[model samples]
Target: MIFSRKIPLYEFFPKEFVDIHSHLLPGIDDGAKSMEESLDLIQGLIQMGFTRLITTPHIYGSVWPNTPEIIRSKAILLQEEIQSRKLPVSLSFAAEYMLDEKFMQYLDTSSLLTIKNKYVLIEFPNFQAPLQLHEILFRLNSMGYEPILAHPERYTYFENVINNIEELKEIGCLFQLNLLSLAKHYGTNVYETAIKLLKAGVIDFVGTDVHRKYHLDTLKKITSKKHLKLLETPFKNNFNLW
Candidate 1:
């Protein structure tokens, strides 16, 4: 079933890919354990047609508490090493700002690191949407950052309320769909919700969200040509596609 498509990997990836979500930076959170592992993962990603990887390490306000300075320093070190090793892929850093009280304070001080300092990726709690979401988005906007809600399809509260994501878009937040979700890697419910969001034209960006080898191994078996076709649609022409 995986190779039913005639083109194989050739036309599937007509160009080198741009993956907006990854945890490839070594020893930050639960991603790659060491620099050697990270380099290996980068090489694997390159062979998968990935040209750019925006590595977003988890920045749990109370738990991880990663500052912009630390994130940038790590990113710089890895970027230089990748270049020195002559790897053909690019690496950049952003924080996966888990929503919390301290995150709000970081927004107030404009200290939250983002992709290009324009697009900020945020994650919610697993089971429910916080009541303070609107206020958080308002504060993020006031600080001149566009909040990109990561993996909205995985949220159970929005499982039947897909329009809520659109409401967030109205409030200046974009939705980034996890590519694995489309493959049903999470579950049937999340997969169905992901397709619902995709068809409704609410998804603005798609990301690999690669955290480990198991994630990449799972991706190798995804034969959803429709998912790839949906990704190539006109609705995917968001500004970040570049």
Candidate 2:
């Protein structure tokens, strides 16, 4: 896990990689605050060698309350800006849906938004795992949505119960590890948990999960050999779900 030499961030990433999780949409949740910031973030991603970006904004009910229409509209505006600027990166939109009572309502009404029309990026509370986690995963499968759990390493509740994550995989849930988590941006516990998951070979995709310019800066500085090794996995970034 120790890197004898520091590799530049851009050199670490594969040119074909497509980021499937981010918060680049302006003024929508906790991502970029305006179009200027969004543009800057996109430019950073372009410089980092990302060819396509499926920016996922937050859709938490109590806080964000972002609907599909709202998310799409913001994405359209951002897309127009990118097009006008002639940015090289292709852009799309999805949501990091918070699993709560409101999400259940959306699922019940069949109104949930998905990434690439098939994959749904979801997260639970960071402090504690949801009691109905199993039931929710089963329901998502029954409803025909491929669920990708966001940043499982950041969830402290799963630290001791790593087997819960294995069970989730057995039940068909995919895991997305945050790129910054591998850099220990969140701290040691999260970093170790991410390494554990990567070693287990359960992570299906990697994402920036970017919320601000600081995130992009951190990504540029990451030099963890473990992170580079994990990126060698056959990630689903090119999964033709889109």
- The lDDT values for all models are 0.77, 0.84
Candidate 1 residue-wise lDDT at 195: 85
lDDT of 1 by residue, 1-242 (tens): 47554332213653645677778888887788888888888887887777777888888866777788877888898999999999998887887888878777776676667776588889998877766999999978887988888898888877455668768888999888887786679999988888888888778887778888887776666664566666664223433543
- TM per candidate comes to 0.90, 0.93
Off by over 4 Å in 2: 1-5, 234-242
Prediction 2 TM-score vs. true: 0.93
Q: What would the TM-score be for candidate 1 when compared with the true structure?
A: 0.90
lDDT of 2: 0.84
Clash count, predicted structure 2? 0
lDDT of 2 by residue, 167-220 (tens): 889998988889888778999988888888888887888888989989989888
Q: What is the lDDT of residue 77 in candidate 2?
A: 95
Single out the weakest 10-residue window by summed lDDT for candidate 2.
Answer: 233-242
